[model samples]
Target: MRWFEIALVVLTLLSGLVWLLDKLFLAQRRAAHAGLLDDGRDPWYVDYAKAFFPVLAIVLVLRSFVAEPFRIPSNSMMPTLLTGDFILVNKFAYGLRLPISNAKIVPIGEPERGDVVVFKPPQHPEQDWIKRVIGLPGDTIEYKGNQVFVNGQPFGYERVGDYVGVGSGAEMTGASLLTERIPGRPHQVLEVDRLPFVDQGERGAQVVPAGHYFVMGDNRDRSDDSRFWGFLPEQNIRGKAFLVWLNCDSITNLCKHNFDTSRIGNRIP
Candidate 1:
């Protein structure tokens, strides 16, 4: 489990313990000594715990099962999600998992193609990454000349224009912008010059294994994704990104009103 998750669990347990002890034992003791000098006073730790228990419990529930906020640290999802974008992920969109353990106990819905998801990479389990789902279990995925194919059907792409990056993402300027139609959804993707159909350590086509997914970055040439590593295990999935709540450029530009107002309330595609 992550450090933040451990902290939440600890806080919740401590607060609950204090509350239970006070209700079952401490309260009776205090009542019996009503006229004593210390009757009206309670221990500092108990007071603090009682005051914080409700608030902590609420936060734990919300963050563990309702939703959680995450900050974008890389441009792998450029054109769809930019760096520094603070996004909210729907925790229960796929299912409900136990806090800390992350063991799914309730069945909700499964991820679909074209859904933008946040997950722990199979190779780097300690880090969290976000990408767009390209292929589901039992489906064959392929990439050739900057084009994507799912189960032998090529996804349609229409060249829109040259993409001009902004803020921290300016390094990707001049990439070709195209509208990629993935069945029901059409989203923009950036592609640099076409490299080989299969680069070193990258596969041209492969069948997605059960309980796994094939994902890729919108910035076709820049992302280190399943193309380079491997499939994303379903158990490692955190949640589906649904909206951008805030955005700010890097620290170097923090003083120039770096807040991106236009992207603040944008919905994640």
Candidate 2:
């Protein structure tokens, strides 16, 4: 959820509490000012809040439990997703869970091998990351010289020629565009020699334990992901990104700003 949504929830709760306190404790003083008898009763603030509290609480419940909107902030999932892509994440698709404290209250389907998932960073729960699931629980993942191996078998790959990333990702122009098979799933990934797989603090392979997943970015060298940090816990999952509502990174196209018609209604894998 965004900061504005967080603020709205906090303010709404505070407002409701204040109104309740005023009605329960200071009702006589408030009613006197409102030209009412000094009998312990509802205050003007309480009356107004009665109508507002339900509406605010409903919004909070629906947004936090039903569905949540998120924007792609980086090129980690590029070729499949780009920067500034506004997407909707199904908050309950994984199962219903209480907001803020992401404890899953219901059981749902687990993430697949090639699924692009959004979750809180294990290194920093405050930070959120989106990436492709490469290794599931109990899977051994190995990345050697740009090749990915899961359970000692290399994920299939096919060269798809050069990738021309527009706007911010233009730096990856002429990078090798390859079709990578993450076991049963196949997706496009970019490999740029100009951008070497510098350790950039990312090192080592991890043996995924039960209820954990190892993720990696499609932009192999550009993203700061599990390779650098670690696996994402099942509880940290937010949802699958499934759309690109809009993309307007450079100001040169402001007047023409709108949905990327080609990307609209596209299913995210």
Candidate 3:
């Protein structure tokens, strides 16, 4: 269950082997040895493959080119995304790519500001992290006083209110909420007032170079993101997160139990 994508790929690859064996040996040998090829009907192996080949191929294509499902596992995305939210990422929104290798075969578009994206961690490519795209290639990103400035322009922000957690986030209930606008993209950000803002300024303002990006989580105080590791390369981008099909972490007394029904069908900004 952990490596669902890997399992899918393995199943798909196995189907190819089954298909090959049925064609090279079973198809020809069954007629001579079993005399079933004269029945004018398909053999058992052929029938079995006929049922599974298309299904496996479709899974491979959709997961690689069209879309993919991912589960939120941490509080990094917090208010915007909870621990049990099952999200659908648009694979082709950024471009089409081959799975595992993740090599882009077509260039459709690139990351834009405020996009909630799923990308391989900069520190560990094997691990995937979901965060808001803060800076694009060649964009200067500066963080000071919990405010973000992109390309020397301070993005506008308005304090919304204190955040209240209903489920698992009950302990962090009184966090600050701010509506942030990053040029073209605008979204809500949560900050824990109890935590110092010093961490954001711990490292000097960073200049994002070409082909690289800066991303951060909504839970600014708790997330282990670009501030901790570094910038993410364009190739590591998986896709943009669009919808949350299900969210169930709160019922089990989990850490992210803030059940915000308003966020259920909310489109990613």
Candidate 4:
């Protein structure tokens, strides 16, 4: 369980307990002693519980099942999603899961090819990683010469232009930008020139097992994704990223106000 999740649970429970105890036991006592007190002030704990309970509950519900905001920390997504982009992930888009446990209890919808998803990497489950889904369950995926082949058919791509990076993404300038057509969805991807496309030692085609997905970064050569580690388990998926609400550079430094207004309110493709 994450520390933030633990904190939410603890705060919610503590506030609720205080409220209940006050309502059941303390309220009557205060009412009986109402005439004796000068100002008739409520207990500090009761006041605090009353003030915080509703706010905490609302935040917990929204963050755990509705939607949550995440800041992009890397340029692996490049042309699709740049670093410092603050994105909103739809928590219930796939299914509602118990927050910390990540156990999906409801059946909503499964991830489709080309959907941008945030999931815990199989090798490093502690960190959250976002990538575009390239292959679904039971599908064979291949990477050759910087092109992705899904189910024996090569995914089509059209050269858009040369990518000009901005802010934190300036390091990836001059990459080839292309619109990749993945069946129903067409999105932008960045391909660096002269980079190897093989997935470690496992060359040729590989089949995606049930309850798992094949994903890759839009910046093909830069991302350490399923190509390097392994498949993303369905249980580890946090949510589908759908929107970029804000973009701010220097989150760690806090020295400059480098907000990219152009990316605000942009929908994720």
Candidate 5:
């Protein structure tokens, strides 16, 4: 589990325990005494717990079951999602999952082709990664000549002029920007056409096994996606990404100067 998740869970539990113990045992004893010498005051930990328990529980429930905010840290999903874009991932869109364990409690829906999903990649299970679903289970996927071919059929691409990103993303300026029609969803992708279309010795085609998914990034050459680390297991899926709520395009500095509001509140494709 991530450090933030672990810490949040531990703190919430500890505070809740303190609040419960005080209410059941300590509170009554203090009330029985009821003297000027014994003021109606809780211990420091109890006071802190009573004040923060409600807030912490609410946050844990909302973030675990409703939606969670995540910042775009890489250009892998560029043109569609820029670096520093704060996106909301629909937790229940896939299903209700345990916060730290990430075990699905209910199977509400399955991932489809073209859905942008945040999942734990096989390479680094601890880190959360976002990528578009390319091939579903039992389907053949291919990456050749900088184009995606699913089930031996190539998807269509619509040229969308040159990609001119703002803030720190300007480094990828002038890259080929095009709309890739991945069946149901047509989203923009960036490709460096000036360079040769290479797969770095990776296979041109592979069949997605059961309970696994094939995903790729919008920035074809820049993303560290399933194209390199292999298929994403179904258990690793965290949620489906849907909206961009904020944009601050600085990594190290963080909202120091590149906080743009134009992309805020935009629904992700």
Candidate 6:
């Protein structure tokens, strides 16, 4: 996807440059000559540039600022988001940003605890990972007994039942499912049986530095997030992942399609 982003920007720029140069320079030259030795036909490259420039530019702007689509390749967000789920991320939810660099150009909002976000992890900036915000800047966060504590107040959790994963998430079956309350929203998190006690001691209660956040996956035990890689830097955020638009799992593969239409349009909690 990063490669796709780079390709999109490069194609858009190349096409737009060709079209602009033709309109401002080559076109005028062709008109001035009229029939001198020319048949008044634009070059093939210019024709291609003129045809593709607008479409490429429109897609680039929309994807860079309005919204963008992403496919979940792992079960890190299982139950909330399944592997093969296609989600639409709100690109300007936190702020407007440049396309490839992801540098914020305008301020709109900050990530609240519990917001699902897609970001470049500090340890692996080339990959995009999604997780729920657990701690804001200056707040202390901890994970113990399969529950999250923020600022010394543990988040409310109610056991739902045993989880039953499907498709790519089948490995998570038999995990304990519970609803956790944070940032005024209630969302489910999974606690696997293999994990015993998760007492991080001093590391669990670490304070989130300014411009950084603590994030964790809904699949609590399986995710490698802030608990493993450290706090998420504000600059690494790509956008808020707010919606799951499609789910195309292995059930839909092997030359046959079995997309789960029911998961479509579900808002990420």
lDDT tens string, model 6, 60-174? Answer: 9999999999988898887899998889999998999998899999999999988999999988889999998988999988877677888899888889999998877889989
Q: Rate the local accuracy (lDDT) of all candidates.
A: 0.88, 0.77, 0.79, 0.88, 0.88, 0.88
Residue 223, model 4: lDDT of 89
Clash statistics: count for each candidate = 0, 0, 2, 0, 0, 1
- Tens digits of per-residue lDDT, candidate 1, 64-181, equal 9999998899988999999989999999999999876678999799999999998888788777789999999999998876788899999999999998999889987888899999
lDDT of 3 by residue, 1-269 (tens): 22777787887777777788877887777667665446756766677677887898898898889888887888778778777677889999888987887889999998888889998985777888899998888887887777788777888888989988755566558888888887777777788878665456336678898888999998777788777788998999999999987667654565255454555665667
- Segments in model 2 whose C-alpha atoms lie over 4 Å from true places: 12-51, 200-205, 250-259
lDDT of 1: 0.88
Name the weakest run of 10 consecutive residues (lDDT summed) in model 2. Answer: 196-205
Q: Report the CA-based lDDT of candidate 5 relative to the real structure.
A: 0.88
Superposed by TM-score, candidate 5 places the C-alpha of residue 253 at a distance from the truth, in angstroms, of 6.1
lDDT pick, better of 1 and 2: 1
Winner on lDDT (2 vs 5): 5
What is candidate 2's lDDT per residue for 61-145, written digit by digit as tens? 8777776667777887788887767677777777887767778888677888888888988776776778888889999888877
Error of 4 at 190 (Å): 0.9
TM-score of candidate 1 to 2 decimals: 0.94
Cα lDDT tens digits for candidate 4, 1-269? 37788799789989999999999999888888787544877888899999999999999999999998888889899888988889999999999998788899897999989999999887777788899999899999988777898888998999988888888888788889999988879999988785554454246899999999999999887888888777889999999999999888667556267877898899999
User: What's the TM-score of each model vs. the native?
Assistant: 0.94, 0.81, 0.87, 0.93, 0.94, 0.94
Clashing pairs in 1: none
